[model samples]
Target chain A: MTATTSEPGLRPVQKSRYKRRSKGRGNFEMWSWVFMRGSGVLLLFLVFGHLFVNLMLGQGIHAIDFAFVAGKWSNPFWQVWDMLMLWLAELHGFNGVRTIINDYTEKDSTRWVLKTLLVVSALVVLVLGTLVIFTFDPCVDPGSTLSQCK
Target chain B: MTATVEENTEAKPGAVPTFEVTLRIERYNPEVDDAPHFEDYRVTVHGTDRVLDALHQIKWDQDGSLSFRRSCAHGVCGSDAMRINGKNRLACKTLVKDVNPGKPITVEPIKGLPVEKDLIVDMEPFFQAYRDVMPFLVTTGNEPTRERLQSQEDRERFDDTTKCILCAACTTSCPVFWNDGQYFGPQAIVGAHRFIFDSRDDGAAQRLEILNDKEGVWRCRTTFNCTDACPRGIQVTKAIQEVKRALLTNKF
Candidate 1:
């Protein structure tokens, strides 16, 4: 068990030496540092605004009924906003996860299985989430011609 | 003591100045090859140079067309990840001393993805998996006037998970991915785990549903390659286990 140069708490150096094949010299580490701060900064806005608009402002949390969501989706602004949030947060989170996966598993088989599952799940979620956001129909009141979803 | 050549062993006869190491690397060419093959490179090398430096030497002196990915020449870019001596590693971060130990170090592209060249594997599938996790926090509560009102403990839950860098080292080194390319893999789970453990996120329920599918978190066997190969030391298997625990107990 050797001491590590990474953050002292996690024993980063030991992990870096497990295979200890070649000189990586902290390239991925540097990019990861940049990514965390960049994504963290972006997530601050995306997460905060998402909360404020969905819960605090205007009608507040209780106003978030099905019809309220439909009404919000009626505007392109909210659509784009939610879209951006979904893409950014999901991508950021996924990359963050990739980092985690690389860190923990020690077996080749185990790592592959988990990562394969991750990619498939991410694809499914992105496809389904995008579809739901774009194709949402708000009104169930088909009998009345009040507002046509079309 | 007299400093004479007769008494010095530094000039000992038959002392080899260099050693030749055998590198059994996987080779692939989209134009000429249907599958990859192991090509051996016997290099007369200095002990101090890293494997990446050796690769650089190969590309520079032996074969300019010996393709591989490298940027930042350091471990941060995650672009130069490869399989070395049966383990995943960032080429730039790996040193020859550690891998060879007076032997040759084998290098190959990461598995679980399509190979682009000698040591470069496709990352689109890896990134595609990352995009699926709905990785951001979704809250329907009042935001604090400042900093979103997360307790230190709550923030700490996701803190360790926040260090990931989509390098594909863990995913490619995995054996399961070598067999089945469709698996969600560790990186995605790590990403989901970041949000799953986040106290402020309301999407845990939804994310759990996504992870509980047939090809979900249950697939992990806990080999710890992700942990071993992770340049960042994230405890990826533990996070996956946590996610599995969350799935079993209705708690994120």
Candidate 2:
């Protein structure tokens, strides 16, 4: 009997033969790797700063009431901070997931559907989040013209 | 090795040995034209010679311009996924002889992703969906001074999700993803599945919140294509179902 080995089918990669696509914008993978490191570094600061402000400052975690949120939104500084956080977190998190999808799902139709849902959802959140942060009103004098919160 | 198997058809049992089948393949060239065209080759094939092997032979002997990506040809690397006839398959594991005995096969690149050159599809958008799932394990507890111990049951629960090979078979198979590129797709579910069952994670409730929005897990139509296409034999629909069940029960 001839001695044989487990078929290379089990070794999907040793044959590697990974030649990057010849045509694309430029350095897609390189920029992606860079983006991960950059985003990771930025996320560290954003996440920590957010935690410190919300959980450790002033009355600390107890200051998270709706009024606390309205108070912060009144200040442009907090608004921008929240905006940046929202955008970065959403983009960073979403982009990371897009990578995983391409790697796993094989069917073109499935991939298409999944990605469509992702974009629609992300867009909806981004738009609504941005609007809420920018157009908030805190004064509630009852019959005042400040809309519902008034 | 597979070619040799075809060579031995005459040595078998009283059953008449079957002849080989040809596989017609689509070819593309960026420098020459705006479209891709078909090319055919007749090769005597056996049950062992997968379509991938046949393509390899054509490249090695007939055309050097033919290009494709394959690593760990056994299907672990998640590369070499393409269309065989109408279904998606890993070129390595799919045995050509089993697919058809009397007719030639057809091979094409996966849809949804931008075709970069020939069989290779651009993966930037797909990768983007992975990031959105928050695939990493996040903990709010104090940093462990020692290895965190987990009950064997907890570990066992998440074992299946951790096995994802990221082959793109499941995601590309969904109809929802075909029209919209932003859907998180199947791998994200697999990634969420990995941590969702872990007792070490406090992020399950929060993760579900992230997945609950309009574009979240609700987009799945329960199509079993993703489950069917998984090279690792993962139950994609099962994982999705578990997540859906959690959302309904936990009310988080």
| Candidate topping TM-score | 2
Model 1 chain A worst lDDT window (10 residues)? A3-12
Candidate 1 lDDT over residue span B1-252, tens digit each = 111112333575655244456677777776886666777776665545567887887788887878998888777777888878777788777766567445556787776576676677667767766777787778877876877677989988878779887788877666554444555688889999999888878899888777765445655667777888787788888888888777667731
Residue A88, candidate 2: Cα error in Å is: 41
Candidate 1: docking tier = incorrect
Docking class of 2: incorrect
lDDT of each: 0.69, 0.70
Model 1 spans with C-alpha error above 4 angstroms: A1-150, B1-20, B42-46, B141-145
Q: What DockQ results do all the predictions give, each relative to the true complex?
A: 0.01, 0.01
- Residue B73 lDDT in model 1? 77
Residue B27: error of model 2 in Å? Answer: 2.4
Candidate 2 residue lDDT tens string, A1-150:
111111211111211122221232333443454466677888789889989999999989987977788878988999998998888888777777776666556556888988988888889989999999999877654554433354
Write the residue-wise lDDT of candidate 2 on B1-252 in tens digits. Answer: 122244455575754343456777766666774666667877654455677888888888878888888887877788999877757789998987666645667776765566666677776666666766678778995899998899888899988888888778777776656534446677778888888888888788767766664455766667787888777888888998788778767742
lDDT of 1 by residue, A1-150 (tens): 111111112211121222223232323433444466677898899889989988999879988876677888878888888887777777777766765675556556888988888888778888888887888767656753435454
Q: What's the i-RMS of each model?
A: 18.7, 17.0
